[model samples]
Target: PEEQFEPDPSKKNLVILGTGWGAVSLIKKLDTENYNVIVISPRNYFLFTPLLPSCTTGTVEHRSIMEPIRSITRHKQAAVKYYEAEATKIDPERKVIMMDDNSDVKGTANKTEVPYDMLVVSVGAENATFGIPGVKEHSCFLKEIGDAQQIRKKIMDCVETATFKGQSPEEVERLLHMVVVGGGPTGVEFAGELQDFFDQDIKKWIPEISDKFKVTLIEALPNVLPMFSKQLIDYTESTFKEEKITIMTKTAVKKVTDKTVEAEATGPDGKKTVEVMPYGLLVWATGNAVRPVVKDLMSQIPAQKDSRRGLAVNEYLVVQGTKDIWATGDCAVAGYAPTAQVASQEGAFLARLFNTMAKSEAIESQIHELSSTLNLKPGNPGEIATAIEAHEKQLRRIKDIKPFHYTHQGSMAYIGSERAVADVSWLNGNFATGGGLTYLFWRSAYLSMCFSTRNRVLVVVDWLKSKAFGRDVSRE
Candidate 1:
C-alpha cells in the first residue's frame, strides 16, 4: 500500500507569502515532505508576467498565462495548505503573520494569524507612481489580469467613440492617441502590442479612424530600455519609428488629467518646454515600488531602517538581523534586477537551502538517538560507533551548502512588426541579435519559460487564433 499525502504534526510549519514569480517558483521546486507547507496570497493563481502585454491587446488571453496555485500544491508529496488572503502584518518576534481575506466571498474567519517556524516573504512590488498627480486616477497599469482586461476594453471604447457620428477630427485624434509612460519592458511591449492590434484588426475593421490611431511612448531617461545593450536599444527605437510610434525621450510627465498629460519635453538643442499631450488611453509602467506589507516589515526591523528600495537581505537571501525569515523576488533588496528570471532563480535556491537544512536536522536527530542507545548499552559499542561515524559524515556533507549565486541568462524584448531584440549570454560572453529571427527566438523562449504545458499550449493557440481569426473586439 502506498502512503497517502498528509501534513506531519512533527514537521515545522513553513509559510510562504505571495503567489508571484518568486513564491510560485519556490513551491514548484520545493520538497514538501520535510515541512508543513502553507501558502498565503491574495491571488489564487500564479500569473506568467512575460506574455502579460499580449493580453492587453488580446494577442493572448489573460487566463492562458495564469496557472492556478492549487494545481501546484496538489502535486506535492505532502499535502500543502493554501489561503487566498493578503498578509497585512508580520510579527517576527512571535513568528506569526496577520492575514486578511480580501476576496468578495468572505467568511467570519476573514482575518487570522498564521504561525510559522520558517517564513518566506516574496510579496512582489506594486506599481510606482512617483507621487505624480492624476496617475493612479487616470492611467491603466500593466501588472495584473484585471489591468489587461481594462486596457482591452478601454481600447475598444476609444475606437468606438472615435467612430461615433458627428465626432470632430480633433476629438477623434485625441481619442485614438494612446500614451504609454515609462520606456521599460512593460511600457515598450505594451506599445508594440497596441500597434500590432491597430495594424492587424483595427485597420481592417475600422479603416476610417485607423490612420488617426497613434502610440506615443514617454521616457524620462535619454533612451528606452536602458537595461538592454545600446545596439538592441537602437534597434528597438528604429523598429518603433518604422511602426510610427512616437518616442519621447528625456521627457518627464509631471501631471496626468482626464484627457491631457502634462510633461517637460527636451528638444534636440537641449531646450526644455512644457507639453500637454491629449490622449484617450494612458498606460503607466514606470516600474516597481516597495509594497506596503514589505514597508511594514521593514519598519518593524531596526536593521532594515536604511533599506529604501525594499527589505535589506543578506547574501544568503535571509532577512538581515532577522532569524528564520527569508525574502525573494521584488520584495527583497538582493542587488539584482526585479525581473522574473532573478526571482525564479532565487526561489529555487531557497528551496535547495531549506531541503539541506531539513536533512541536517534529521541527521542530527538520528545521531542523538544512536548516542543515547550506546550510553544505555555499552556492549554494542562497535555497531553504535559505526552508525555515529556514518551519521557524522552525512551531517558534514549536509552542512556544506553553498551561497546563492545568480546566473544571468540574458534579456529579450518584442518590438512589434514581427521584430524583436535580444542580448543573450553566449559562451563566455554576450551575444546581441535583432530583427526577424530574434522575434521567433523571443516567442520560443517565452513559450518554453511558461509555468506549465497547459499554459504554453493555450498561449500558442491564442497566438494562432489571433493570427488567423483576429482579436475579438466585443466589449464585455
Candidate 2:
C-alpha cells in the first residue's frame, strides 16, 4: 500500500487542489516530469462556467461543457494521480492535507491525509447567500452541473403543474413565474436563457400557458452588471425590456420562503417598501464567498488574519505566512475580480515560476557536485572554471522569471432575444458593443474557450440542435 501511493524520492510532490480554471491551467502547462503531481477535487471534471447558464434551459447539455480530469492527466508526461475527494483541511505546518471522499457510496477509508512538498490551493469559491434565510433550502443555485439539471427539471415540472387539471388561474400564474436574484452576468444570462426557452420552445409546447409566463430579475444595486461598462449595462436593460423580462433595480431580497421571495424596493423618492413575490422557480446567483477549507487555512496562518473572502497571497501567488504553499483562482485575493480570466493567468504564472525554481535547484546541485569533484581531484582549474561558469549561466537564466501580471480581456453577457453586450479593450481604447453582432462574438469567444476540442464540438452540436429542433423540454 505504501509503495502504491509513495511519491518518488528523487522528485517533489506537487499537490494541487480543485479542478477549476486555475488548477486545470496549471496542470496543462506544468512539467509533470519535474515533480509528482496529484490532483484532488470533489468533481472529476472541469466545467466551462461561462456558458453554464445555457445548461439551465437545455440550450446546451451539461455534459457538453464538462472535460474529464482524467482526459487531462492522461496527456501529461508523467502519471498524475487524481482523487475524487474534497479537501477538508490544510496543515501548513506539517505540509499535509486532509481530504474526504464525499460521494454517497463510501469507500473503505473515506478520509485520508497526503503530504506535499509543494501545495497549490485552487479550490474555487462558493455561492454567497449573505445569510439570507431559506436560500440554501428553497432556491436553486447556478454554480454546478447538478444545479442546472435541477433547474431544467423544475422548469418543466412547473409548466406541467400549472396546466394540471382544475388548476385555478391564480395558481397557474404563480407556478409560471420564474424569479432570478442578482444582476451579475450569471443571473442576467440565466434569466435571458430562461426567457429564450420560454419564447422558443415552451410557448410552442404549451401555448395555453402563454401570456401568463413571466421572468423577473431582481437586483439590489441601482444597475445590473456593476462590472460592465455603462453602455453595455444600458444595452442589457433595454434588451431585457424588449424581451419582456422585468428588471427590478434597487430591490434587495430580505428572505425567501417556499413559494415567495420577500424583497425591499427603493423608489425614486428614496422610499423603501417591502413586497412579496411568488414564483415557482427561484435562481440565486448574487456572488461568491470563501470555502470552508480556505477559511480554515486562513485561521491557521497569522498573516491571513485580515483575509475575509479568501486566502491572502503575495505577488507570486505564494500564500502569505506559509512556505511552499500557493493559492490561485477565487480562493486567492490577488487584487483582481473572482473571474476565470484572472485565475488562468495566475495558474500560468505559477507554472513558469515552478519550472524556473526546479531548474534553479538542478543548476545549484550540479554546481555543488562540480565544486566537490574539483576539490577532491585537485585537477586543472580550467575544467573546474568552465563547469562552474556553465552552471552559473543556467542559474542566471532560471532566476529571470517574472512575477504574475493580470491582463483584462473583456466582459460579455447574453441579454436574451439574440442580443448580447461586450466591453472589450482594443488599441489603447475601449470597445463597447451590443446587440446581434456582439452575441455572435460572445458565442465564438466562449466556443473557442472550451477546455477541449471534444467539449467545443459538443457545445456547438448542442447549439445547432437547439436551433434546429428547439430545446428539449422533457422534465427529466
Candidate 3:
C-alpha cells in the first residue's frame, strides 16, 4: 500500500490565503513539517506580476510566468492540502474561514468552512476604478492573465476592424487609438510595450494604417513614474516624446465609454478643460483597491475602521487588534508601497517569525518537562539541570527576534526602443541610470527573480523567439 499521510493532530493548522507573491514567498521559506499547512486560493498558480505587461503584446507568453501552486507544495516534507477556491468570509471569532469554489465546473459540495489555528491573509488587491462611470464595463484591466489575453485579442480585433474595406477615416482612427490610463509603472510599461508592438510588428504587417496608429498615456499627477527620481522621470518623458507616444499629465479620467474616454485636463495657466478622446483599446492600470473579502474582515476589526486603503498591520505584520492572524502584500498597509519586492520581503519575514516561534515553543516545552523530571527523579538532577540550562540559553537567543524591517532594493521599469530605467541601491548609495544598458540589467534582474529555473529558461526563450521572428500576433 502507498504511504498514507494525514494532518498531525498535535500541530497547529496553518492556513494561507492566495498564491500571489507574498503567499508563495512565505510558502517557499516556511518549514511545512512544523505545521499542518493548508492553502486556499481561487487561482491554482502563482503569477509573476512584474512581467505581466509583456504578455499583453505577446512579447512574453502568459504561461511562462505562471508557476503551478501544486508543484510548489508537492516538494514539502509534509503533505500540504490545497483548495482552488475563493475565501468568501473570514470569521475571526469562530477562527474559521468560509470558502467557495467559484469556478464554472463545480461539484455538489462547493462551499465549506476550514478552521485554522493561524491564518494569513495575502489575497492581494483589485484594480481601483475610483467610482468612474463605465470604467469596469468598458475598460480592460491589466492585472491578471485573463486580462492580458483579452487585451491581446482586442488589439488584433481593433487592427483588423480598422483595416476593413471602405472603413471611414474617423472610425479607423478611433479603432487604432490606444489609450492607457494611470501613470504608474504598470501604465508606463504597458504603454511602452504597446507602442513597440505597433512600431515593430503591427506596422510591418499592416503598413496602410500605420500612420493612424497612436498610443496615449494619461496621468492625473503632474508627471509619470512619480516613484522614480527626477532625472529618470525626465528621461522617460523625453523618450516617450521621441517615440511619438502622447503623455497627458495633470489630466483626470472622468468617464469611459465603448469608443471614447472623457477627461478633464489642467492647463499651465490654471485653466481646466474637458475633452472626449476616442480610443479602440482603453487599458486601465490605476493601482490597487481593497478586495471585498478584505473589506468585510476590516469591518469586523475595530482597529481597522480608520484604515481606508487596506488592513493596517503592526510592526510585525500582525493584523491590528488581533493575534494569530497576519496580512501581507497589497492587502496590508505596512507603510510600504504595494510592490512585488515589498510583498516578498514581508512574506519572508513572517516565515522567519513563525519558524522562530515554533522553535521557541519546543524549547519552552522541553524546559518545563525537564524541570518536572528534576523534581520527580532526583538521581539525574545534575544532568537534567545542565540540559535545561542549555535549552534556556538557546531559547533566549532565538526569542529575541526583532520586528519586521523592509529594505528597499531598487526600482526598475521598461521603456520602448530597447531602453529602460533603474534606480538601484548599491553599496549604501543610489545608482540611477536609464537607456539600453539599463534595459539589459532589467531583463537579467527579472530573469533571476523568476519563481523557478524552468520559468527563467522559458522567459529567456520567449525573449529570444520574439526578437528573432517577432511576437505572435494571432488573436487568441
TM-score for each predicted model, relative to the true structure = 0.98, 0.98, 0.99
Which pairs clash (backbone N, Cα, C closer than 3 Å) in model 1? none
Model 3 worst lDDT run, 10 consecutive residues: 1-10
Mind giving the per-residue lDDT tens digits that candidate 2 earns over 1-476? 11234468999999999999999999999998799889999999998999899999999999999999988888877788999999999998898999999999897999999999999999999999999999999999999999999999999999999999999998998999999999999999999999999999999999999999999999999999999988888888988998999999999999999999999999999999999999999999999988999999999999999889898898999999988999999999889999999999999899889888888998999999989888888868789979899889989988987778898988888988988899988777889999999999999999999998899999999999999999998888
- Greater lDDT among 1 and 3 belongs to 3
lDDT for 176 in candidate 2 is 94
* Candidate 2 weakest lDDT stretch, 10 residues: 1-10
Predicted model with the maximum TM-score: 3
What C-alpha lDDT, on a 0 to 100 scale, does residue 378 get in candidate 3?
A: 99
Sort by lDDT, best first: what order? Answer: 3, 1, 2
lDDT scores of the candidates, listed in order: 0.94, 0.93, 0.95
Q: Residue 198 deviation, candidate 1, in Å?
A: 0.4
Q: Between candidates 1 and 3, which one is better according to TM-score?
A: 3
* Better model by lDDT: candidate 2 vs candidate 3: 3
Across 333-428, the per-residue lDDT of candidate 3 in tens digits comes to: 999999999999999999999999999999999999999999999998999999999999999999999999999999999988889999999999
Compared with the true structure, model 2 gives a TM-score of: 0.98
